[model samples]
Target: MHGKIPMASYDEAVASKLRRVSTDSLRFGIIALIAFLTLVDLFAAQAILPSLVVKFSVSRATMGFAVNASTFGMAIAGVAVALLGRNIDRRNGIWFSLVVLAIPTALLSITDSIAMFALLRVLQGLCMSAAFTLTIAYLAEHFSPGQAAGALAAYVTGNVASNFFGRILSAAVADGFGISINFLTFAALNIAGALLVWLTLKKTDRMMRIDADHPPVGGAWKAHFKNRELRGSFAIGFLILFVFIGTFTYVNFQLAAAPLALSPMALGLVYFVFLPSMLTTPLAGRVARRFGPANGIVLTLGIAIAGLLALLTPNLPIVLAGMALIAIGTFLAQAIATGHVSRVAARDKAAASGIYLASYYSGGLVGSFVLGQVYDRLGWTTCVVVLVAALIAATIIARPLTAPRV
Candidate 1:
């Protein structure tokens, strides 16, 4: 028959190409390791929050300060990395950052004073921010357009998986061995991640060649911020992360009180809700490609709002279901928004990624403190209301993404 090649043949060809590219390039490995390390850092802090509070005799407000300190450091480091682009070898920057990150992470195990622990976390945040930004930039630069979304999704999956594993592992270890041991184990994981990056991840010499041709425009940041689509995407990222991190940070505290009275391990089970994100992120990307990022974002935000509202009901199963919905929505929003930023950024994909990430972490920092205080004063109902408000703001901002890119 004189017919065109079968669609299945095209699919096989694409899959074969992807396998070859992934095997030949070290970028995928680097992205995976960075994602792993970032999770380690995130979970190390989160897993220990309840234990730290008990050990140090600190209030939720103070714990919020600790969380803010780390995120604030991440924001600062993100800005610095953006400015330092091309001036430094991206590989060297990431490696140096890994070393810097290791010092503080390792020290967290030995530190007795809350002050010292917080300081270490802040330093860890700085190092991790730089490492993460560079790694993400490298992946975007190295991968082809066809593969970029999947690569980013894989990286994000690493992050979501780490969130699930980190908390569960830390809580389990804390239950059996001790909290200190849990921190130490995460520190070891960080070190291992660093080594994996250093050894297996190829130096980005070839990738740098690709990025070097697209030199930075002097005021690229200004140009990027001017894009309505990017601004909207960024806002969505900021708001969604603010609510997501804030809720996760304090969920343990909420559950530990009257009605639920869940143990640390039981509370850690909430992270299981996040597992769906790993499965949903790639699907979200496909949906975004078909329906457009704006539509995906709107749908996801609506789901998130519903999830937040469902928390108002006092049923545990309902609350868990709500949390799952929130996870799916958050991941969908993140995948869509991040893809939007990468596509619409004027120049310097790394810098754009840095800006987006900086906004994201800044929201976490601000939200952690602000929402924690809100919860302290007004209770869980007020906190849910705040999250719903943030989601509404996200929906408003996301509307701009539907506008023709200027």
Candidate 2:
């Protein structure tokens, strides 16, 4: 009878904990909402580029400058946040960045000149990147290593959701109401997300304050880089997004040409294959906890490689099936790598995450700019070959993560 009583009490306790688990959802939703607001513009711009070119009487190449500008800004902001803004409170950093993001995003609606629009995009990128970097570092620092894996998975899931839905939503708005309305609507959402962050996510984790009190900016990098495993994490981080951005960037061009010419709406729907990553990414944390981060990464990258190979065939269903696999693998790899950074960096966790993200966004910048030309000159097959090689290199770089020390 007493054993039965204890078992009942234990079950009740578990139920109580499950109720509190809803808070994680709240926090995840707020962070995800903010990410969605900022990233929607990034993906949506691709769909709206033709409208932009027509509106400004500019060349397609010139219209691309805005995206490139934002990518550059994100890279610079990531570095700056890592090095210069080490002491900023995480909550306040996010709050400030959100408010700043709202201004530029709103300004984007009213800006007439292409140069001015590009400038606003750069500003928005700076603020958005800072917000994202800080939120990731905050999530990593607050949770236990195993739990951090889950938290980071949710975070990346939010990012994947943004990638899938943001583009679709933004493109729809632009199609229905014109480009200005799209920017204005996104700007309003940014402000609302900022308010939610400020009101609900009010307190910073105390551990973060303790961790931030470490070596100077350069020394912090030196400390993280000194760890061989962390360095591999950074490299893997760079390469994961490098291939992701590169593939998606050029696939649009490929789909728009030849026998498989697809409309803009169809292109956006093609990205829907990535929607599964919202499921696959969160599961990544569980995979890492069970299989170890190293093995999880290798498995996911292998899947990505296979997906890229599938693209070599000219069939649309086969190509899309390949893309879905690539998206799943990329998100899983990123979630594992991102969570591993938080686990492995013994100190200056923010710096570690910041540098990792800096590497990530830099990969995006380089892949889009450099590989766009690669596609233009060498064609889709060559681009796919380059991405496959890069994924293999990422798998090699991530091998150290399997070591006992890691």
Candidate 3:
């Protein structure tokens, strides 16, 4: 009787927390916008890569640097923010990151040299990592554990929004006016997002402070590495992104080739296949809470593998279906994995989140650069094989994370 009463009370407490987080529409919208603005510029670079290749008269391998540069910068920034950024207020950090991001995004328009373009991408990447890492850390810190997953899902949906429109809009604009205009348009949006963040979050900024009275802790690096669950989560983080980026980075080129050539705008539309991620990610928490995070992750990975296999088929509709499945699986798995990271670390959660983000973007860099080389040398078939292998590896690593709480 005693055990039953406490258990019921605990459940009620968690339910109340979840309801509160779900109802905070204004705060959720601002954070989601920050995530959207953070990633759009990077995806815009992906969309314009083909144009840059022609404009600079470079090989696909060389043109890939444009994409890799930002990812590499994001990886670096994740680590830096994890280690060095503990003292800054997250609300100010998020808006400031966007404000800084707009500078390089605006500069992307006029840069003629490939080297300079890549350099600007690197700068934008650094700013992007701050918003990406801090927003989720903020969510994790503010929401109750039971509610954190739902909040993270909302933020991640914003990420999916950027992924879908960033490339398509940029490609459409680049196809019509020029790549320069594409960059300029997104830059304007970035500035507007920054203003929105400041305006919306101004009143509540003090309430959301991550580490209020505690002195910033040290040894975060060693402590995070020592935690077994965290180690597994980081590995899962890396492999999932490695597979996701590897597939998408090269698909555009494949679609532009002889068999089923697509226009720039059409190529952008193809990314609509990824639109399902926006929906799947937000609902992922319900799935995780029902089944368990580890089980949910493995199930999503299996779905992703099936999608990759379907891509091996040459039929356009089949390929589109395959892309949709991959999107659903990838986002589902990522949402679970990311929310797990936020909940697992009790102290210096921001730094722990940073390590996970660092690994995640590091995987992206490898996927875009390393697998891109494989595509250049061997063929898309070999690239697909590599991505499948990586997903399987992630599933294996996630085996230890079966409990829903961890």
Candidate 4:
């Protein structure tokens, strides 16, 4: 009897072709550009935080609010975009959002009032939220599952690289000109990103179209809440980010003062912690593929907790070491968790992503405020304590992952 070729061979052949198609597509380039812009916005704000505090004579608590404002705006916009569903042309929506995002970023260059700056930051957050959600959704729609993970990881690498370079650039510019100029530089970057997307991204009819049969548009939110795995993942995301933001937000202050006494340039170099993410993100996908995403999440969270404890040692080398550990662990966790959500919620990918991201950013917002207060009231040690508590909570949530749904 003649033997037949295995099904796996056909799948591998199809996957290889799709990968080639995806890599050559203009959509991938646009997505990567958007990802780069996201990081620029994030670091530009962070790099200038210390300067802003000194200029306005604002307390850490107030600064926390300003920093968290971006996330708050993002969370709101995510919900709104998800609820709107596939009715809108995602490409146009993303482009429009970028234009909106650039406005507030540029406005930072002109405004001297703290109140105005804070308001602008919030608008930037909203625009960012929409842009990110739409871009990811577009990618998921266009690429096959096997190709999507690599593409997503590439997008994330753009984010990590941007954080690294954006911080360095902002710090250098601030040292030469001023913090305001740093904001302008990022604004220009965003404008350039928008132009790139406009020129490159192909307009397609792939947008999600909601109709009468899909009458349960509003029900998607409620439906996502019903997902136990998704809820657990969101909780962990919120807690982890809360601590992550809180720690990074006040770290410059800590370094600038006391034993470290690092200048802005020196402190900016600490952002090298982001570099490992470029590697860990792809590795995370492999780990998730082999051992399952839930297991990868738990493992990463444990590593993060250990990293947080390492920072408690009070040695400069130990602190940097700890930061590196946290960065690796957090990135791994995010990569796995994001991929898990996409895989699990195959039908409502965009809505699921929006919800998960909302949780992720909302955690940043709440963490900034709560930890800022902890820092003010009890000091850095207390801030660490809050992060430890959040880590413990993540561990508890992660425990359920052990017997995860197949």
| Top-scoring candidate (TM-score) | 4
Residue 340, model 4, lDDT: 70
Instruction: Output the TM-score of candidate 3.
Output: 0.87
* lDDT by residue for model 2 (1-406), tens: 5899899999999999987788767766766675665465565676555567678886544565565567767878887776666467777888778878888888888888989988887887798888877776677667787766556556666678788886776667887888889888888877776786788665664434425466666787888888888999988988987798788766766676678887666766777887777877778768888878888899999999999998888799999999999999998898789878877888877678778888887777777766777776787888899999999999888876853454
| Residues 1-406 of candidate 1: C-alpha lDDT, one tens digit per residue | 5345677788889999999886745555556557877656764456546777888888886876684577878888888877665555666677777776777776777787878877887888898788777777766666787677667767887777777777778777777777677767777777777776777656766433224456554567777788777777777888988988777777667666778767877766666877887688768768777777777798988988888888887678888888888888987888788878877875676667778888888888888888878878888889998899999889878775752355
Candidate 3 stretches greater than 4 Å from native: 1-23, 140-150, 203-218, 404-406
Per-model TM values vs. the true structure: 0.87, 0.86, 0.87, 0.89
RMSD of each: 4.2, 3.2, 6.1, 4.7
Where does model 4 exceed 4 Å of error?
1-30, 210-215, 402-406
lDDT of 3 at 169: 91
**After aligning candidate 2 to the native by TM-score, how far in Å is the CA of 379 from where it should be?**
2.2
Task: Give the poorly placed runs of model 2, Cα more than 4 Å off.
Answer: 1-18, 21-24, 53-62, 110-114, 140-150, 203-207, 210-215, 289-292, 403-406
Please give the distance, in angstroms, between residue 336's alpha carbon in candidate 3 and its true position after superposition: 0.9
- For candidate 3, the lDDT comes to 0.80
Please write out the lDDT profile of model 3 over residues 1-406, one tens digit for every residue: 5999999999999999888666776566766776787788876666666677888787776777576678888989888877666566777888899999999999988988888888888898998887777766667667787667556656777789998988889889999998888888989988887887787654234333334454554566678799888999999999988888888777777777767678888888888887777877787778778877788899999999999998887788888888889989998898889878877886767677778988988888778888878988999999899999999999988888856343
In model 4, the Cα lDDT at residue 84 comes to 79
Candidate 4 or 3, higher TM-score: 4
Model 1: worst 10 consecutive residues (lDDT sum)? 206-215
Candidate achieving the largest lDDT: 3
